[model samples]
Target: MNKKVWLIYGMLALATSTWGSAFIAGKYAVLSFEPATVAFLRFFGAAILLFPIMWIMVKNHTKPTLKDYGLFAILGLTGIAIYNICFFLASKHAPVIKSSLFIASNPVLIVLLSGLFLKEKITKNNIIGMIIALTGVAFIITNGHLLTLFQLGFEPIDWILLGAVVSWALYSVVGKIVLKKYTSVESTTYAVAFGTLFLLPFALFETTWQDVQLATWDAWVAIAHMSVFVTVVSFIMYYQGIKEVGAAKASIFINVMPVSAVIMATVFLGESFTFAHGIGAVCVLTGVYVGTNTKKWTLFKRQNKLRVQTKDSA
Candidate 1:
């Protein structure tokens, strides 16, 4: 693959890995900080860090118009402030497996929404790839029993999860267009800044320095990891991916998240890798291959095979 494709792959992989491991990191951070507080600190840290970098990147660039700022404010509210609050609250009440499975359908929602809002094509290969990828995601998360679909129930909290995914789908599809007006750096920074602003009131209500003061080393490490890698770096990569690939194709990479999380848990948390992991990984990769515009290698091989067959016939 070309450098551009490789860069996209690398960025997507890193972002997903950081996000996958965030469950562990968040688990640690929340031991001290409230979920709301953790959420706030993440955006606040990202926004603060981005200011200097944003200046360096945009100093000689066109200034974002007031209208652009307005759109960014909405972006923050939807993607960062609102989406996270809903996710945390829903996670408290929703069944873990069901939530994972449903959230894994995030790409599917993005594919459909991109078609509607972004006018991106939903191709046959993309559809087939999404199905295969999601099937693998469900298989791994459910440990391949497959009967959990019949057993799952949708409580009211589940709707919140659905809302969270929809909010993010809008964020991804909308942000793709927004990037045309702003640098990836500028877009990410402004959105995060606004999101942090909106989150301040709620976070301040629950946030106390006592938890931070009392936090263990592990908790602090997790806080930094989430703030830097999960929120900041991951958001940068995500926006870049959306800009490089269309939203639907970019979203497909998220299927790797469950696999990443499980692998991280196994290595760091001393969990076991099972047959389901192996199978699910294969399926996930296969799905990604199909979903993406990565046909050059396959086409090359097919052409070579055809040439050899013709020579043999002669």
Candidate 2:
């Protein structure tokens, strides 16, 4: 409505677009480095920058208790280490667009997990949307051969991408607990620090100092982009959008991610968009919209209208 609001919207869009591009950058990074190494490098770089930023942004920071350390470790493991490892591994095997689509479906899983674990309410729309979104994911993964999933089972890369999605959902669910105690920036910074530590041994096992030194500039650039833009800057901007617009309104910008990923993959990676992708994208996006906007749906509107009319008649 106003200039500031428009600017916030722009930042939100740009943040999501950068997230889409992270898949592309990850695809490039995994071409040269092992998945563990690539993940380690990206987060290690992000951790370096995030600590100082967190320090500056969050004043009156108290010392972390032992429980806080444990929580941070869990966040690091689920959201950072495991998720990124699976992501880079999947990037090595799957198309970036496909990977992005899988990640885009994360909200469905988050909603389900929240209902189960957080004692949150699950509406009929949530169930219907989950079914539709999963159907789309099946189509995308099977290349529209959904029927064969029973006979053929999932591809290994599909499992890996699913792992990433589940890990991210868990990260978000756990983050709800952590955020109640700490600011998002503070929690994220500590989590990234611990995640970097967790990744170190695996990175060392997979690659030596010589190997790290020999990594191509393209790989370095990709890791840098993922660390600086995708992880840190995008998170900040998205959080800002949430602060200004409310989470539900800000979340609508996330739909732009998979679409942007498709476009970026086409333009930068020269990847082809398939018929299955088109169909799957439609289903997933529509399902996500419905899943998130339960109160805004026609049935709910009609129900509200009837209630209002009944009240007026009385």
Candidate 3:
């Protein structure tokens, strides 16, 4: 409702849109490039694009310590490098909608993990919100066919995607600590750089020089979109939002991703959106409202109190 919250909401919305559209982009990219290759190029492009901005920031601001760099490295490796690689592999075996649904669970996982590790309070509202969100995600993913639950079995790609989710959750948790010590830009830049370094060897192993040359124009365009919009800009916005709002509240925005992805798929990829998708969208929106709005009103009241006190003192 306030300026900061509005800024965070705007950033989260932008990040969600970029990431949602990335499914279509990534699908096209992998058509000509290997998964690892795409992952490598994506991060490499981000690193290249962000390098100048990081340089300027580092020059004008204080540099982070070696310890901070280590944290950034870990965040980058898990969040960017591993998550992208695993996601690409997962897309190979599943529908993009299904994969996006699985990733939507990251917010719930974050809440649970935060409660366990960071000692964050998990209130009744949190539980109810998570259930609603998960239910919506399930509905969207399963297309209202709850009976398919029995028929659906896990594949290797599923495991890879599961790993990606776990890695991303860990990244989110650890990033909270890292952000305390470094600027969001510094932390993001270093982590992305480290992740790019880790991805290079894997990309080399999976791709050849010929594969690079063989890529089509469409693949190049997809790679550019992923690198510039999704990887670099979206990540910047995401971290900015996370800094403005705490990680728990910031993560609720992920629920919007599936809805965005569905819309993008329908428009660009011509994927059908059924009644189930509409119902799932409602559920996700409802859950996000419940989860984000519970403590928000209280927080807003506290902010008003602080502002009034400051004015009185002045």
Candidate 4:
């Protein structure tokens, strides 16, 4: 409503749109590079930018112990190495919109896992929302034929994207622990460094020096977009938004990511928007809303009632 809030919101929207654009970029990158190579190049470049920024911004940086290095390695393995490999592979085989939707549902999985592992509360609303979101994902995967899941199993690409989701959930869960010791920026920088290291061997296996030299200009541009916009710049803006607006409000902007991905994929990749996609989008967005916001809504209602009662007593 105020100028500052509006600016934060705008930045959040722009940051999320960059996330959406990653799907389009990944689709293009995989056309000219292997999934492993694409993943390696993107994060390797991101690390180059992230480390310097972390050094400059985090003045009270602490040296990590050996255990801290272990945690960073896990974060890298799950969030960076495994997640991006599956991400690019899914982009190669699945529509970018579908891939984006699958990734968007990550919060559902994160919530479920947090409840189980982190001893977080799992409200009735959380359960209901998860079911709805999963149903929507199923609809998208089956092309609105829910029963086909029994006769025809998930496509390999669906599983690959699901791996990406699961890996991200694990990353988030582990990140909670790491964040207790480090800032998000520090943890992320270390994770990217380790992930790039982990990816180097696989990338070398898939790509030769000749392949890297001969990569198309489009591929380089796609990788640069992911590295600079999605990883570095967008993340900085998103974090600033969290600082200004709080995480709950900041997270609501994530809905824009999938929508932007759909738009970009449609315009750039010439992908179709099917009826099934429409239905799934509605369900998924609705589910994410209910799951994430139910607690806040309930709290607000209770506070409003308390205020009204106090006024009546006066």
Q: For every model shown, what is its TM-score relative to the native structure?
A: 0.74, 0.94, 0.81, 0.94
lDDT per residue (tens digit) for residues 47-161 in model 3? 8988787777566666767877788888988988888888888655566766776676676566667788899887766677678876776676668775565589445666787
Root-mean-square deviation per candidate: 4.9, 2.8, 6.8, 3.3
- Candidate 2 lDDT trough over 10 residues, lowest sum: 292-301
Report lDDT per candidate: 0.72, 0.90, 0.78, 0.92
Candidate 2 runs further than 4 Å off: 298-314
lDDT of 2 by residue, 45-101 (tens): 999999999989889886789998998999999999999999999889999878888
Off by over 4 Å in 1: 1-16, 86-108, 154-164, 233-259, 272-274, 294-314
lDDT of 4 by residue, 1-314 (tens): 79989999999999999899999999889988999999999999999999999999999999999999999999999999999999999889999878887677788788888889899898888888888888889888888898998898988898998899999999999998999999889999999999999999999998988888888999999999999999999999999999898989999999999999999999999999889988888889888887778787578768999999999999
Error of 2 at 83 (Å): 0.5
* Residue 245 alpha-carbon offset, candidate 4, angstroms: 1.1
Q: Which has the better TM-score: candidate 3, or candidate 4? A: 4
Model 3 ranges with Cα > 4 A deviation: 1-12, 58-66, 237-256, 296-314
| Model 1: per-residue Cα lDDT at residue 210 | 76
Model 3 weakest lDDT span, ten residues long: 284-293
Better of 3 and 4 by lDDT: 4
Best by lDDT: 4
Report the C-alpha lDDT of model 1 over 1-314, residue by residue, as the tens digit.
79989889888878876777665676566667666677777778777788887787677766778888888988898888888777555444543333444455565556667888788887776787678867776665567776774587444675687687788878877787788877878887888888888888988898767766787888778878877888777877886788888766676677767656666666665656668756766676676666664354357668999999999999
103: Cα error in model 3, Å: 2.0
Candidate 2 overall Cα lDDT vs. reference? Answer: 0.90
